[model samples]
Target: MRIPSLKLLQGFEAAARHGNFSRAADELCLSQSAISHQVQQLEQQLGQPLFRRVGRGVELTVAGEVLQQSVRRALDNLQGGLGRIAGYMDPGLVVLVCPAALAQGWLQPRLAELRRALPQLSLLLSTDESARFVDEIDVDIVIADRPLQQPDVMERRWLRDGWLMAAAPELAQRLAALPPERQPSEAGLLCLEDGFTDARAGELFRAHLAGFRRVGIYDDARLLLDAALRGEGLACLPKLLAAEALADGRLQAVAGYPAVDGAQYWLARIQGQPRAAIVAEVYAWLARQTEEA
Candidate 1:
């Protein structure tokens, strides 16, 4: 009941993937005969033929196909572990992952603050949220809403979406002056569109505004924000995102319109080591933002 050597498994996996011993040998920096020898040793140990000759190349047998699946997964996991080690070894590096829309809407607006907070830190800001939070090995912080059950990962309340109807200063006043009946068709709405039906704001406003004109329907809130800034129309936007503009008098929340509280996003971090100083700074900034909420 002994396991085959790693070299044997690597050889078998590479050969099966390439369907050619010479190609597999080239990839592993070994000769064709050496790769063949390793595969032979593995087959003998497992008491089954792993590959069958097909013309100038080879193909996996039924047992080999099953083993290939496991071997590929094992190698991928090992690679991810090693990559995480590399990230830890680099003292200044902090890998941050967040949703694209959030990055555009939130981080882009706070670039100055981010630079001031970590002048010496190397920040890798990734906006690809398609991958599952736990499977991301090298990432230091994740801004996500998905709940993770793992004990080793720490989660904090990050942001709760608060949707409000808003527009540029001039437009806000105009919308306010309109009678309630005519506001729906005349306000000129700039809508936010996302995978969610509401885009966090649309559904709440929809019931009241039946025939409103769409100035534009944008996938990114940032875009809709820009249109609102240009005095395009009233938009359903995250109040937190518009806070700075609202304070500066660039945008104003339309009064007496229905506003809805939306979903909350969580800040997730790995609890164990390979920690960077920059990671703490980034987490602290997010913590402060939550505190502000």
Candidate 2:
């Protein structure tokens, strides 16, 4: 059997995948007319119509559908093989997605140690606020709050518990000075944005505190901590972000308040891919950091 022209096969494959000559042409960097001509030539050679015009787009014929399935599988196998070869040669390119606050307060300081440990590895970090890590972004690892289990991804609980709490030395003093019945009403309160509270920090203030004035609401934890430091009011902050402040006497834990549960951080990887060496190293580093923290 004679093999078809590679260019024509490529054009047909792209057109079939995209279902439009214009899109296929864009992918191949060819004009739409050129892609159409190539597909027509291939169909003529095969003595069959591969696609049928349907409204504004084309739909694959039975033969075209079969060819498309084969082409998709071939492309996937080729990509996987190339990735494996690249990994073998370098094993250094690691892409990670982490929460913005963690990336700023916790992970940034420790990155030097990671680089020292894996001198050859290149790190690419992306910030993701969403609990669900999108696989389409092509990250090697994602650090996020544990969500319901996702298929084809391995989830490991990095931090067992964490929480958001409002605290400051001055506010603590004020609260201590206030009478028991009036303290909750007069105490300054800082609230984080609604999304953060819902995902990580359960609604604790509604149950514990009485009517209170909103001092401020902030999006970034670091900024919130700064406000707390400035005595702008009590800011609800993550324990990890406020740990240093608490130690240095800039902040104090509010007494008689129920302990808020810490948000569990998770490390996730798509199942079945060979773990990149750098990703494994970073994961270990994060685990150690959590343990030390």
Candidate 3:
């Protein structure tokens, strides 16, 4: 059998999800009768009753449920494919992907310099750490813990980074008054959720910060950094992320919890990609920041 039109499928899915034809029509900016007409077309084409009418709304039949799942998945995949195509069509665009914490600490401060360096190129920033492969068609450059194996990409060690334990100045001072053994327990701890940080936070805490109580576990390093700034508790995070705050004296390094060494990152970029000269200049600027830091 031939497939039905996308318009009909869209109407059916929205109506099924909302369980109210009027609400679905409102969401789609169509009249209630238009949605009902689309549903009728779909039901007639399939020769089945997709929904059962109730007092003021509707409920999906088994067939409707099955179709809804498949339609939702197909539409989502279609949207993703379209987005990728759009990226390819933009010639002046340069996509850069890095960890959120790295972006917050390193890129956020240096955006003006980057814009000055690449005045003609449109820089697209993505904070998804999983997009760290230069070979990914959507990503042109990445700051990653390890280098991509593809020969078409070139990589350099940006910096050797590690976890740094710090707290607000007042909190650090208060903790300093306590004995070394009691400092961690007295101050408590704030950190990223398990597997979020580059190092294994729980294991590191057990090995170094025994008897410490966790005050908060955040999914984002930025949030954890904010918590530390608010004097919520001592925060353990990537050194590169906390370095700026520490240098400026907004955050003070807590003694006895020296940095750990497994958080190094490498900068990788695809060779001869779109706008090579501009990308090269931007990449060089980024590398220079690591040296200055």
Candidate 4:
């Protein structure tokens, strides 16, 4: 018997999995007619009617069901084997996902250390605010606020802390001249807009600045820090990101106020999967770095 086309099998698998040609087409980025054609070709090659028409849709026949299971298992095994080989051959490719702010303020600065520590490793980083892991994309690690919901994933807490009110030294000095109650209102306030809802902001504003006015809302911590440095206003920022500034006397924490307990950062991986040497090394390094920072 002649070998059937792998592409045709893939099309059929997608259609069977979704139970809809339109959905399969959308996923494969092909026209519905094209997907239907491929399925037709696949059925022709197999010399069997794979699908039975039923009220605006199609259901898999008994042969089709058997073929679908075999195809799925074969494809999964093929992909898994390829991934294992790739992981062995190119162990350096570490795909990571993190929040944008964490990527910029925390990860970027220490990436050089990571590179030096794992010289053979290459980094591919992406930002996903919502926890969405693409299994096929080969993401080995993720630095996120919460654990991934996917089964068989393990999460390790890297940093569990909160936000503190910070202001430039000069701005602090100026605020010191005003009455304690009026200092926040008289001074500028730099707000981090990312991951904040209107209700959360309102609550935070009410708690932190009962009488203070919001001068600016910034999406980036770096920008907020810059504004604070220029004596713009006080900014509420993660202690991890603002640690250096706080230590350098460039920014001082507003004393006598309660700090907000933000979500912790987690390093995640597939539970049963053996960690690649480089991935293991990087994870350890990140843990140490966060601890020291």
For model 2, the superposed segments whose C-alpha errors exceed 4 Å read 1-91, 130-137, 148-150, 164-187, 195-203, 247-250, 272-275, 289-293
TM-score of each: 0.62, 0.56, 0.64, 0.60
Residues 196-286 of candidate 3: C-alpha lDDT, one tens digit per residue = 4344455667677767788898887799989999999988877778877887899998877655774678888877654455667777777
For residues 4-79, write the lDDT of model 1, one tens digit per residue: 8888999999999999999999999999999999999999899999999999999999999999999999999999
Candidate with best TM-score: 3
Which model, 1 or 4, shows the larger TM-score? Answer: 1
Q: Is candidate 2 or candidate 3 better by TM-score?
A: 3
Candidate 1, which segments miss by more than 4 Å at Cα? Answer: 1-90, 132-137, 199-203
Q: Write the per-residue lDDT of candidate 2 for residues 130-182, one digit (tens) a residue.
A: 53553523676788866537777776778654554546787778776765457
How displaced is residue 50 in candidate 1, in Å? 37
- Residue-level lDDT for 236 in candidate 4: 71
Clashing pairs in 1: none
A best-first ranking of the candidates according to their TM-score comes to 3, 1, 4, 2
Top of the candidates by lDDT: 3
Candidate 4: list runs displaced more than 4 Å. 1-90, 134-136, 176-179, 194-204, 219-222, 289-293
Indicate the residue-level lDDT of 175 in model 3. Answer: 85
Query: Local distance difference test, per candidate?
Result: 0.79, 0.72, 0.82, 0.75
